[model samples]
Target: MIKLQNVEKVYRTSSIETLALNNINLDVKKKEFISIMGPSGCGKSTLLNIMGLLDAPSKGQIEIDGSKVENYNDKDLAHLRNQKLGFIFQSFHLINDLSVIDNVEIPLLYRSSTAKQRRDLAQEALEKVGLSNRMKHFPKQLSGGQKQRVAIARAIVGKPEIILADEPTGNLDSVMGNEILGILQKLNEDGATIVMVTHDDAMAKKTHRLVRLFDGTQVM
Candidate 1:
């Protein structure tokens, strides 16, 4: 469902150019569960950002579900990203001021869905993440795992085709991390495409395929 060919990402300043990704080539199929493993500063998160359309590659092509994203206008890219990609981050990225349900509803608020419909979808998403009872709670009131689940709920509320998770279990203990991994496995089984970046080898092994990177290049 996603393809990257010779993708190169360079971060530039007035006097320095840092290469974040170098000639990344990958093809992720629909409903596939893929794990990206690498050391710190190895460009794993950079790759995920590019794949999710949050950042553009410097000199390569990115195709999502057959559309060449490099040529897409900002609005088109935003539309496609909202329609096709979901993201879960290590930091959870929840708005502390918003309630769990409100956080989950934020993504759908941009779409044409009515209030009731958005609420219904958000509730369903919360239920999927085992956070239905905590919908009215704020992020600060929840544990780290619960907060991450809320983030996952927000990610899936729109039913995007692909989920890009970066260090999804980074802040959780082993038990809580396992719980989150189980949810992701179930989602994959139910036909959701997932590409997750993790430092844990055990977590990486849980996915169907693994890709390792070194110095911004895919080495395995």
Candidate 2:
């Protein structure tokens, strides 16, 4: 349930201007799993950031669930993102000192939920990622696969409608990457819309559709 119309992103300095995305018009339907693939500097991540509301377009419109987001203030965008989106990054952005469950609970801290509610929700999310038994362990104690699973748990702890994954498997071995892909597949089947940016062709092939970018333009 996301749409971008004639979107463009540009980074400007006193000496030069660079266009990151050019005339991007995309629509992602509910529960659709989309893969965005491109070479480095081809705007895949930029497009994902705009879709995730992590960044804004220099020009054009963005709509989430039929609501225009182009005019939203930062506070409103943050509220909307917290309520509607989840993010999975390749680096597994977990706090080194926090236990698995504690990391998952971080997102709920912004919501109006009780500690107990947050704990329960975090537990459920961990269970979904098969990490329930590791809840008390610190990130350093986990394997690469387990750490990525922890990241997945944290993302879904908020029960977001859409999941934006930026190279979720980039840091893992092939087998572990496959495991993460299976987890994402199951999430999509269970009704979460997923838009992933990946450099791996094999990973991209697993999604419902592939959208390729080149030189900041949609090539396929």
lDDT of 2: 0.95
lDDT of 1 by residue, 67-100 (tens): 9887788899999999998999999999989999
Q: Count the backbone clashes (under 3 Å) in each candidate.
A: 0, 0
Lowest lDDT 10-residue stretch of candidate 1 = 65-74
Model 2, C-alpha of 127: deviation from truth (Å): 0.3
Supply candidate 2's per-residue lDDT for 120: 98
Quote the lDDT for 27 in model 1. 98
Give the per-residue lDDT of model 2 (tens digit) for 1-220. 9999999999999999889999999999999999999999999889999999999999999999888997799999999999999999989999999999999999999999999999999999999999999999999999999999999999999999999999999999999999999999999999999999998999899899999999889988
TM-score of each predicted structure versus truth: 0.99, 0.98
